[model samples]
Target: MSRIVLITGGQRSGKSEQAEALALSLSAHPVYMATAHVWDDEFRKRVEKHQQRRGAQWTNIEEERWLSRHDMTGRVVLVDCITLWLTNFLTDGQTTEQILQDAKDEFDRLTAQDATFIFVTNEIGSGGVSENALQRRFTDLQGWMNQYVASRADEVILMVSGIAVKIK
Candidate 1:
């Protein structure tokens, strides 16, 4: 059976770093699953920075949708975040239920493999309520997504100011 670890936190809260460390500890050659869809130069720069940080040792996989369709057997996988992945669905006009079902589908397929999955998501609901409708909708979707992944995860961690707090 596959092992699932869910890590959540606010922006720049060390969630990705924590997930990367844990994945490396689990497997010598873990897969870095890049889910970000760069929308501008700034974001592209950020992606470049992350790529530089990971270096050539990690196998990078650029996938934005249908996560379960990928073959990840016998490899540890690090999904830098559920937030960006879900955002892709939302931007593509996917309904909340559809987004969730897709996530669940990925979970089901992943658990049947021999891979160790580390998922990083943002705890976006903790901040003050959003005034924009789309922001609000995204927030709700992110919350639900985090909950679903955490519930199924063997280990759940919350990163706060670069410190990892074990939650499950």
Candidate 2:
């Protein structure tokens, strides 16, 4: 059987840190599956910072999309963030509904394997509503995706001010 853990928080709320700690506790050499797509030098540097934080015990895999292609059976896999993963699909020229359904389907396929999944995600919609239409749309998509993942997760943690509060 598979186990899912969802960690969510606002920006800079230590969601990744919590996920990393949980993954390390579960496995000595956990799989660090990053879903970020480096679009520029600044973003690349940010990715490097994250890479530097992890020790040599982690097996890193960078996949912008199609996470179901990776067979992570019997392993502990930590997916850094759902926001970036969703962003990758948002640009595919598909409607929001289509993209959401595809994301949910992909998530289902990936979690079907007998492994432990620790998912890190941002809670962007908790604040004030976005003024931009695109931001609003993305926020909605992200929120829905987060909810979907959380529903399937065996445990859910909400990070607030670098503190983890278990919600499920």
Q: Evaluated with TM-score, which candidate comes out highest?
A: 2
TM-score of each candidate?
A: 0.95, 0.98
- In order, candidate lDDTs are 0.86, 0.95
Backbone clash count for every predicted candidate, in the order shown: 0, 0
Please tell me which predicted candidate would have the highest lDDT against the true structure: 2
Candidate 1 lDDT, tens digit per residue, 1-168? Answer: 788999999999999889989988888888999889899999999899888878566998988866777889989999877888887777657787887887778767766787889998999999899999989988988898788888889999999999999989
Off by over 4 Å in 2: none
Q: What is every candidate's alpha-carbon RMSD to the true fold? A: 1.2, 0.7
lDDT, residue 50, candidate 2: 94
